[model samples]
Target: MSSHAPRSPFRAGAGAALGAPALAMGVSFLAFGAAVAAAGLGTGWALGASLGVYGMAGQLVLLQAAGTGDPTGATLGATAANARFLPMAMALAPWLGAGPRRRWLALPFIAITPWAAAMRVLPGLPEAARLRWFLGFALVSWLVAGLATWLGLLAAPWLRPPLLAALLFANPLYFALLLAAEGRLPASRLPILAGIAAAPLAVLLPAAWGLLAAGLLGGTLAFLARRPWRRGGG
Candidate 1:
């Protein structure tokens, strides 16, 4: 008889990310890889941005600004596009730990996909398991994004024009799918509903500010809707 080691929670979490969501993420980054190749930024830059930026929209923003030959504007644009991460990190903090040290370690990984999945999945997990699970999932997702970016760049030049257009929609479509999948959970749906409903009103602002407003507003509404003050002794 052969024996296999029992998987840790971290490995289990990573396995979860290997499914449909990760596939969509990889498909979506194909466009980004193409864009990076088109931009002449090289594979190193594409992979670095995929890891360091983490957000698809932010990577696009950085790519666009890079063309202007102004590193400052590129940096600012990417930062602005990813401003939604501020509220996300805040919302995820209590789940990671009460200590700033733990929070800081995990906060950097709070991109849309992992954060959304975490919000939907973490409450049911043991407190000790949540952080490890989250890290495992997010790290795998990040690696997949980086790998897809390189592959996309290599394949982009050979891909048909129409196929490239289709790839661009994959990420947003995955987000929509995730929202629908999590809709069964009432608590989890609150912020998603709020963000979608409020995003239109935010259109008056710049893209980054609009993103920030939607995330902040949605997170605040969800937090308050839960009425933590009554529940909190912390």
Candidate 2:
């Protein structure tokens, strides 16, 4: 029999991507909006950042850095955080359509996030389905965030800190809920461990460096730890 894997349920569940993933993106965008407003950024600027940067974590980091009078740091931070997109891009490459489609789709990849990528690569999905799921997930993120940022800026003084905090908090909360639902066996534990370890390290290490380390270390450890299919094995 052919060894080709069956289609991923998560991919077919692209509909769900429009749900939870969209909600998460909206919440994060709202938070980013608040932060930008508080920092005295104009609505145009906030929206521009969302459209251009598309990375909630990176955007937040850049804004914080900018608030501290370090545009250089903000630039560096954004760049560093964006570096993680390379692996995600590679994962997504297979599902993308040919030629200009791949190149065009790659544009939004700049804003790729763990949740977005995870939703796109939903296990057990077919290639076409995975592509659709990813596009939907990414589109929702762009729209929701752009709107939220605009709203946050328009509201300004009232929404800044709390909304930003909520947005930041929402990401992990969403992940935890998802993990709780999906994390039953030992094999699934590696991502959970890496997720737990990632945040604190992201805060400690230089922006994107933390993500890179976690991905490498967590992936390597998981690979090494795998055995037969009894309890845990790939």
Candidate 3:
């Protein structure tokens, strides 16, 4: 009865809304709210930063750097840390349409994480429904995160030290949970192993440089390893 095949990527992207992604985001926002409040920032400021930046780790780095009296350096460092976004932009090009006009319009929407992930997986989905699926996932993630941030702001005032500690733990715990969930994916072991190898270097190198170096080195190794395996038995 349908004109097109079913789209697994769309379903997977949408499924995240009901699973780990949503939970991780919600918990992270709660922790971020408590931390920002404890650091003496205004609620409006926290909300504005989250809305504008949309990257939790980047926002935290900037907040810590600026609060310590290096606003300019912090901004520059944050910009550097976010350079991974360039690759993400390239990834979105196909779903956004190949035309220049469409590309320009798609730029703003690129900030949405769900859309970014959907783009990565959309090639495996039904061609006709890919865009719709991407939009659905992006909209839901955006709305939910926005609402959670606002709610967290309202609740921040009452957050005791114990509660704040609990909130802080949520972030790391969620990341661990996400890694566990991703174990089922093909080639997932590569990222897990790379992350393990990079852990010490992550502490030794400066924040921006460490992230960039790890990404480049790990990606290069992964690509080189896969090529030989793909070519023939290696």
| Clash numbers, per candidate | 0, 5, 0
Better-scoring candidate (TM-score), 1 or 3: 1
lDDT of 2 by residue, 1-234 (tens): 565865344343344546676677777777777777767777778888888877766776777777777788778877676666666566556555445454466457445443445543545565445555555556555677788777766665676565567767877677677676556656667766765665465566755467766666666666556645646533
Can you list the residue pairs that collide in candidate 3?
none
Q: Which candidate is the best by TM-score?
A: 1
Give the TM-score of each candidate: 0.85, 0.72, 0.76
Off by over 4 Å in 2: 1-17, 67-70, 97-106, 109-126, 181-187, 194-208, 227-234
Q: Kindly list the per-residue Cα lDDT of model 3 for residues 23-71, writing each as its tens digit.
A: 7677677767667776788778777666666677677787788787877
Question: Candidate 3: where is the Cα deviation over 4 Å?
Answer: 1-16, 95-121, 228-234
**Cα-based lDDT at residue 196, candidate 1:** 84
What are the lDDT scores of the predictions, listed in order?
0.82, 0.64, 0.65
Candidate 3 lands at a TM-score of: 0.76
List ranges where model 1 is wrong by over 4 Å: 1-6, 97-104, 218-234
Please state the error at residue 74 of candidate 1 in Å: 2.3
Between 1 and 2, whose lDDT is larger? Answer: 1
Question: Cα-based RMSD of the predictions, in order?
Answer: 3.2, 6.8, 4.4
